[model samples]
Target: MGTTFFTPNFQTSPVLQGPKTAYTKPKTREGQAMGNFLIDLSIGSFIHHLYSASNFFKEMVVLKSNEKCIMELSRWLHDRTGAYDWKHASTVVAELEDKRDQHQNIEMRLKSSIRQVLKCNFEQENITSPVELPLADCVVSGLLLDNICKNEDEYMKNLEKIIQLLKPGGQLLLFSSIDKSYMIVSGERFHSFKYSENFVKNAFDKLGLIIDYCAVQRRRSMNECNDYKAIMFTAAHKGE
Candidate 1:
């Protein structure tokens, strides 16, 4: 939402701790490291500390649904001037890893790991149909599906599309805002889909995904948006 979700300027912002922590978890890292390629869907502010996977994957492809997001990521990856300030997020990541002084190195690793930035259309059955993105060893998508789809049916279809992008037994990292209908971005409200934990788990089960890890962090206090009650993180693997 206009970089609001990725900025860590505020001390209370969960963007730094929530996602980075989930991504760096020992088991998650092990699964991610099993492959050489990663495909990131809806690459928002998640651009920061991407180095978390630098050691795991030889190359990374970041796919976004909008032109603006793609442009923002490209600027940051190339170290352009107008890119969003990700130092705060990167600092937190360094501290979490007990390498606070090596923050710059971590940031650089993330930048180098990314090989391409591309656009995707989730509404279509094959998100990158004409372009034909390679099926990846891992796919990470955060807060994209619920915010983009209008209804649950569309959400399910798109979820399948994302899974189709992964190789068998490949890992999928997902982050979602639970029970949210709308969020404010740059002073304007954006629509979001609402769903419960059961609904999410049922959908994943129906898709034959093996859930390896799941966690939910409830909102501590209302900050920018009143749309979500909790943040949901899940890691699963595609069936063989």
Candidate 2:
């Protein structure tokens, strides 16, 4: 399973320093990034979205679900060792922004945009208790609920919890795993709920969120480390 992570396969290989072709840079909002405060939940491990977001958002709040994840992200913010190199990911983001030479500027903007990093528990009633968070103009989540949620019911509950953190008419950006039952991290096995595209759309629909964009990618490559067959990306906005 260890050897499966960085294999030649696109689905298994880490996008960090792997083949550029394997990395699929998602589309960002054109014209202007519209958000005063962007709240990101558990997207710390991958900072690709931050680069694109820094352009529009003045402030960013990172809600980490665990201490270790916060520590790893903090290492990168502090320029310490052991932090995963996200230069490649940011570079691709820069190109997408039509500023190929401004990758460093993008990084700087990202650092400036991030205002808060708090550790919270998703299982708790109030994800971030004691500290009241401001309603955000936008919210971004990366493979969070799928890993921790035991079933669709729990997933729905967590979705409502996350929505409460966003302002009315605010947007939600979700990066989810589709049809995945397990994932491997640091040689440890983690559980992931298997869900389909329809499942996700129905979840959001039930919450009254308007879906602006949605797609699911089924990777041709396979690996033994996890049972993920596809990845899902959704951009939706809350009703005013």
Candidate 3:
């Protein structure tokens, strides 16, 4: 069976919280130019990460592994009625960046920055087959490889595929769970590939990405849904 993309209903998890800091504090290599576009390949339907990024990139492209996810996210972006409330997330972002007065309008700015929503399959040999996309200045992926890859080899291959979407010296902002083997979504258990911090660093090194900044936050609260020991955030850039 092909890999399934599951959209968990729970929001405001620790994993979701990490991206707020990541987007605000991501460090890139000196002298590297941040190009015009940024692509988001994150799992789940949270736009909290994009709030800070929208100000940096001229255009943003969000990719979902399936059409169902694309349609759902597209609706969430364009339609405010009955959409997931992002006000709290936006408020946190505004406060973090000292733009507290603009918190109420952050969502509207994010929506305007989005250029398109496209379907993408990271497991496929060609992640963007049939539809050509421009190489992005930056790529953001959160909790995607662990959920989709069955093992370390598959994880590396998929990571390579994600990196291929970047131009030379492009930045990659990655958020992942460390040493997690599974996650429970809406009462259904799903597989999560287990790996360590060193494994991820080694993979990035092998892929020719220079790690500029990395931080790990140990899980402080007990949660029943997922067994992630810690959350890892890495900011890396490709070589020119």
Candidate 4:
């Protein structure tokens, strides 16, 4: 038998709970833990959707444009593992070794756009281009340094931009850190200004996105998020 976690409804349900599972424990090694975790967890979330085929009416697109995350994920799964199609993802994973690079990872925003276009067999996906999109069914971002939105307005504007991209009935899944900083394997600090729930609430409110759920989870083993007060996962539903 295979591991299954298909949700019947996408109504802001709690997909993951406490006792967060680390995707990988790099243990100071330049590891492939993230690549493996990405392919696996990424698929798990989708397979759950596939199983909920009866409820998944609209098509999906991700928005992760960060260079490090976008590029690395691209090279690993598509060129390297062929993430275009989910067949034998496990097999492809078995062949890779942990070799993540600071520059190798792409931005977190480009991911959804790429996949949206790829659905048509890597066809030209011209959805998220010049001028920005104001309505989408879903948006996903690992707001790693969430603490930096100190100015409040700047943060809300960015959040508003993202919310605008989502459709009224769409969902926005955000993964972020609760602290103001992070330390990558290189011991480099990814710092941002501190933030509050009020700030987050206001951002979503300005964009007319309603909060559906929030979860505090353990950092993926691949992540060295051990120093954070908590890892936040928020599922917001866009309002009309």
Candidate 5:
């Protein structure tokens, strides 16, 4: 729930990696070069990275705690639109769960923890490739695509693919950012994305996803360490 920021050093986060050989951009002109403006504009994606020094440690604690992991995965049921809750789930430890935790009664806890671990926001769809997924749900397995699809087209395609990632009744919790913001990482200056609420809403609509929570950035405080807070939530899934 802190300012989420990402960057080229993403791999060092112990969560989202910055680059991957398997992940590739669309081979077309516009798609390949989307970085001209849109990529630079899509700064919100990296905002999640800013979290490393703040709540990131708390997140790491949660990942190390079984109880916290359970509470985290329970949010997956909130994905009514078949989209995973990446922000809240970026730090879960479900892959290493023991066989004893897989029992039906304890399954919820295990799923919850694993679900949080799969909070790779970019990997909404199973397009990239089958990953050596930590034993969790089918939806979270599309991690490779989320990791590889850095470009906008690949991102949108991944979102589309996420529609199928969920089971018939699974939920999707999606959201996007608004307002322009800035952050500092590794002693370098960077900016958040300049996406409008409408832009994000329409973008998700392209894939038939819905919004369960809609909170925009408020001027929290100029004295705060971070600069921007244009946050929002999209928690729903393929409604059939």
Candidate 6:
């Protein structure tokens, strides 16, 4: 098993578009604006989703489970000379919004909003243990739980830990693959925990989170890279 990084196909997947919709489509309560602080704990270093979120959040923090991922993503965000080319992802975002020509501006905005990158271990004894970091108004995670957790029990447990990082009334944006057992990266197969949509909704309900929006995109085409039946995007909020 090798470490999985962002690939062009993964970046262009329909499921990957869920974050933008989660951020932009929902209607907030009257006079209520989006959050000031946002934290992203997605599995890989791919940041295409952040471009949409950068427009709303005042500060963005990226948490990675490993130091290597942290260092790589940090360099990509801060080092201009050796930064990975994110223009393609930006263009996809722009096209989604029908603003193809403004991709450059979008890219710049995402780069500016990122405040820090830190290390996190989701498998800790007390996953919800207090840390020096402040609670975020919103936490965004993509394909993280399924990748890290070994079973459904651990998945739900880790989900609770992630929610602990949010403030009361804060929201959670989650992206997951439905019935996905594995994904191939660079011709290497990596394990992905399989779960159903009902399981996820129930987990949120059990935790007392109110789900605001949900979307599912069934696999429209076949590819040898993965065996996911569908992708699910959910936006839920914790009670105050």
What lDDT score belongs to each candidate, Candidate 1 first?
A: 0.74, 0.75, 0.77, 0.40, 0.34, 0.75
Q: Write the per-residue lDDT of candidate 6 for residues 1-240, one digit (tens) a residue.
A: 111111123233342343222222222232232468888999777787777677678598888887777877877887647766767678767766578899988887888999888778876754434456788888989889988988978988889989988899888889888999998887899998999999899999999889877777677777787788977878888989
Q: Which has the higher lDDT value, candidate number 1 or candidate number 4?
A: 1
Predicted candidate 1 versus true structure: per-residue lDDT over 1-240, tens digit per residue: 000011112223443445233223222323232567888885365664355666567689988889989888888888898987677767767776679898888788888889888889876778875787778888888788988888889888889999999999887888778999887776889888889988889989988899877777776667666558877778788998
Q: What is the lDDT of residue 156 in candidate 6?
A: 80
48-162: candidate 5 lDDT, tens digit per residue: 2212222112211111112333344344434445434443222322221233333332333323332223223333244323332321111211112222333457656756655
Off by over 4 Å in 3: 1-33
Query: TM-score of every model?
Result: 0.85, 0.85, 0.85, 0.51, 0.39, 0.82
- Off-target runs (Cα >4 Å) in candidate 5 are 1-112, 115-128, 132-155, 190-192, 223-229
**In lDDT terms, which candidate is top?**
3
**Higher TM-score: candidate 2 or 5?**
2
lDDT of 3 by residue, 179-237 (tens): 89888877899989999999999999999999977777777676777888988878788
Worst 10 residues of 3 by lDDT: 1-10
128-232: candidate 4 lDDT, tens digit per residue: 454343354455555532633445665665565555555556666566556545444456665565655555666666777677665564433354643565556
Name the TM-score of candidate 6: 0.82
Q: How many residue pairs clash (N, CA or C atoms closer than 3 angstroms) in each of the candidate models, in the order given?
A: 0, 0, 0, 38, 33, 0
User: Could you give me the TM-score of model 3 versus the true structure?
Assistant: 0.85
Residue 169 CA error for candidate 3 (Å)?
A: 0.6
Worst lDDT run of 10 residues, candidate 6, spans 1-10
Better of 5 and 6 by TM-score: 6
Single out the weakest 10-residue window by summed lDDT for candidate 4: 32-41
